[model samples]
Target: MAHERIEVDLPLAKVYELLCNPVHFTKFLERIDDVEKVNSQTFDYTTTIGGEEFQWTTNIIDNLRNTRFAWITINGNLNQTGTIRFTPLDSGKRTRVDFTLDYRTFFGEAEEDLAAFIEELPVQLKKDLQTFKDLAESDTFKDEESSSEKVASEVA
Candidate 1:
């Protein structure tokens, strides 16, 4: 099990909305190559990690608007379950993000391997979280949102 936290420079609702879109996962998650929506709450994804590419499917277990989003991988080379919780801070202009992951590696469950993963996981997680922060603060994401709203308004 590994847990990490990051503060994002965006409103809680905006962060939650961005995260709910699986299309943005690859942008923040390192080595993620593809994401295919299996259903409203399921996704099939491909990732390259440690020089190997594998496929995984994740089923969303719970989503509570801006509070929490949790999921479990049902089929994959790696078995993992994770949750992200959002807390409004700075008068709701920023969000404190909490993330947790419990994973069983594809490698044999040797004590040494598990320990190594445990030690290295935090570094990867921090990098990914920083990537997410950058994306959330970038103009590209804002442009995308504005474009989406434009289309929505036009359709109505």
Candidate 2:
């Protein structure tokens, strides 16, 4: 479960490029340390999640010509298969991305229900889009938590 939708201001192709590049995941997925291609169709990912390090493998299922792409996570706490659809809007100046995640929990786990997870997904997903937007639109990207300093002027 845990369905989320994020819209990146970048073009469909640009977003697609970022998705296709497995190595680039480390930039956003801070938990992911490295990725290696085990074969032509499989990629292994090494990540440290919740202070626990683990490895996972995923397979590329289908990919359309800048239209849709799908994949599945072979092994992990987040076992889901989803697709990303790209739609051109505003006369191709912008692109709309539709992302869906579908998965199941073992049972009696902390996060089990899919519907409930989907409900509160927007907040987290939107934040991710903001970060993605900053990276895609400009060459600069601030750390996940970087704040601007406010200096007080002497008025008294």
Candidate 3:
């Protein structure tokens, strides 16, 4: 298992909304090539590592709006589960994200190779979290949010 905590400049609702939608994951998650929504609570993700592509389907196990989100992979090449907790900070002006991931490596790998992968998991997780934080804080995200709100308001 690997855990990482990051504080994002966006509000809790904004952060939670982003986290709930896997379609936005490719923007921040390293190696993720695509995410396709299977349903409101399920998605298919494709990732490439070392010139090999892996695909997985994930089902949402928990989705407490503005609180926490959890998911488990199923019927895919990867076996993994993860949870992300959202905490509002600065009176809802900002958010703190606590992310935890547990995964099993592919079968048939050498013991030494598994050990090396495990050793680097935490560092990779930390970097991924930082990347997410950076994306949430970027002006592009803000502009996108504004545009979405604008479209919603116009539709209303």
Q: Residue-pair clashes per candidate, as listed?
A: 0, 1, 0
Cα-based RMSD of the predictions, in order? 6.4, 9.3, 6.2
- Model 2 has how many clashing residue pairs? 1
TM-score of candidate 2 to 2 decimals: 0.66
lDDT of 2 by residue, 52-76 (tens): 5556677878878678877788875
Writing each residue's lDDT as its tens digit, candidate 3 over 1-156 gives 899999999999989987777767666666466777889989888765555566888899999889999999986765668899999999999999999887665565525544554567778789988878876788464344332345568999
Off by over 4 Å in 2: 76-78, 102-123, 140-156
lDDT of 1 by residue, 21-127 (tens): 66567666664666777899998877655556668888999999999999898888766678999999999999999988766766676355444655677787889
Query: Which window of ten consecutive residues has the lowest lDDT sum in model 2?
Result: 145-154
The true-versus-predicted C-alpha distance at residue 33 of model 1, in Å, is 2.1
lDDT of 2: 0.58
lDDT of 1: 0.76
TM-score, structure 1 vs. true: 0.78
Please list the residue runs of candidate 1 whose C-alpha ends up more than 4 Å from where it truly belongs after superposition.
Answer: 110-119, 142-156
